[model samples]
Target: MKKIRIQCALLTALSFLMGLSQFIIVGILNNLSNSFHTSIDHVGVLVTLFAIVYAIMTPIINLSVGHAPLYKVLIILFSIFAIGNMLTAVANNFNILLLSRLLTALASGPSMSIAITLAAAITPPQKRSWIVSWVFSGFSIASVFGVPIGTWISDNLNWRFLFWIIFILSIILIAILYRLLPHNLRQKKGHGFLRQLAIFKNTHIILGILIPIFNFSAVYIVYTYLKPLLINKLGFSTNNVITILFLYGLCGLISNQISGHINNRKWTKTLVSFLSVQAGSLFILFLTSNFKWLSLIAILFMALTMSVQNSPVELYYMEIAEQKYPQSLVLASSFDSIFSNVGVAIGSAAGGYTVNTLGLGYLGLIGGIFSVLAISVLLILNKVYFQ
Candidate 1:
């Protein structure tokens, strides 16, 4: 019990740093743009490229390295992540920064998926879902704590300094994880990476993956542009905008734990309900764009519900995969991570396009449309898969 607790805590802290590193760029986009002498939209493309690389690399690494010992693989991959951050910190041009992002993305996708696998492996079967939640809540914690700090640092210091911080944190975590985890942790040798692809033959499995894709797309379509919405649309000072983001992140932290604690029997219903609420919140966000106070409440609601839905959806998918296609968890996790990156990649890109063409105010309606689609998929999953 003590061993598992220490493992979860260290893994959670590592994931927190992962989340922090990924999101710091969003908070410091203005700094990057100014530093690179580029447009904000152009800087936004960095996110798209990073996600695309992550999506591309996740499966490749999983396929090739899934058979390797967990602790050793993680240490090696984490080292790559640290190196990538160092590269970014030293980058003098946009192209170099872009390349550095690709490097980090490549290592990041596999590292995260493996971390999830490690978390599941180290715990009791029934407690696995909660462990996953606790591990991933590190991401929410990044939003709650790290983003605000990074934003403040960017406002006061050089943007490159943020990557330097990520570099140091990554290196430090490697040591911490080494101390906490056993060496050479290994999984049941599944048939192979190619066999993992068979898990998708089941429509339910495929839809399970798609649920989060659409869900993330829905939230990120607007969220990717949140700073602009708060600053330009709602007439918030930068510091005030950060404050609202802090509130939003706080709500997200609350939601992350909420999903993990919900009764397992309620997983599907909770998922469907949250998707519905997300759709409604997004619609209200669109309609109430002109109403500042209403929009603020809407943001909080969206962030809270948006985050709460994620763990349930992911837990459900992993549980189903574990039961139905037990040996293909590596593959399932790989695909999950791939689609997650693809979802955010697509969402951020679409959001960028919407900002350019349709304007940020319409982002909510567009997001709501996707939210409805996700809900529709979940309803079908419940009917076809669960029932």
Candidate 2:
């Protein structure tokens, strides 16, 4: 247990860097565009490109490397990730910066998938969900806190400093992972890429992959334009908006921590309850837009439930995969990451469309509709499968 905990912590750090590096781009997009002599929109595409690459590349990489020596694969992937960060820092033009992001995204998806796989492989069945959730919370933590810190650093120092920090942190994690991960955990008889693709044949697995997309589309529909929703719609000043965001992030971090301890045996109920409240929060946000205190409450509730859905849903995937597709455990992790990226992209785009068409205040109402759609999917999943 002690050794597994240490490995989990180290893997958590790796996951944190993955989240940090991905999101830090948003913080410094203008800086990057200025440095590269391009449009901010072009630089923003780096974010979209990174997600697309990660979503597309992860399963492809996993088909081949799934059964390789785990720690060694991590080392190689982390090395690529660190070097990509370094390349980004030293990039002279937009093309080089884009290349760096592509390399990192390619490595990041598989690296995180492998980390989650190892987390599951090393732990007992009963604790696997908790461990995976713990690992993923690192990403949540990075999103809540790291992005702001990176933005602040960019404001105070150089924008490249963010990647420098990530590169240095990743280097430290390499040594920790080497020292912590058990050497004997690798398997040689895992499924090939084509065989892993067979998971799509399983209806439950497809639904599982789409779950994040549904849930995230709900959350990010409002969250993507959160600042505007808070200011233009809810009438918050800039500093108060930051404070509200901070509170929301704190709720998210706490929610992720709580998610790690949830009972998987009742995951259907757990998922439904959280998703219901998630939908309710958006509903409340939609209704209470004019009431400052009520609006803040809705925002906090939204943040709290946004991440609490992770562990149970992940547990559901592992349980389903373990029972139906034992050889595709790592592939499940890759799918999780891949689907999550797709979710964010879809949600952001949808939110942008809603703001343009219906208006910003209507974001929560539309987001509520998305969450309700997710709830409908989960209910059908439970009735058809879990029962």
- lDDT scores for all predictions? 0.81, 0.79
Counted clashes in each candidate structure: 0, 0
What does the lDDT read for residue 93 in candidate 2? 82
Candidate 2 deviant stretches above 4 angstroms: 26-44, 92-95, 228-242, 287-294, 356-359
Model 2 TM-score on a 0 to 1 scale:
0.89
Q: Which consecutive 10 residues in model 2 have the weakest lDDT in total?
A: 39-48
Alpha-carbon shift of residue 299 in model 2 (angstroms): 2.8
Best by TM-score: 1
Task: Give TM per candidate.
Answer: 0.96, 0.89
Tens digit of per-residue lDDT, candidate 1, span 169-215: 88988998888887767755777776766677888777877876887
Best by lDDT: 1
RMSD of 2: 2.7
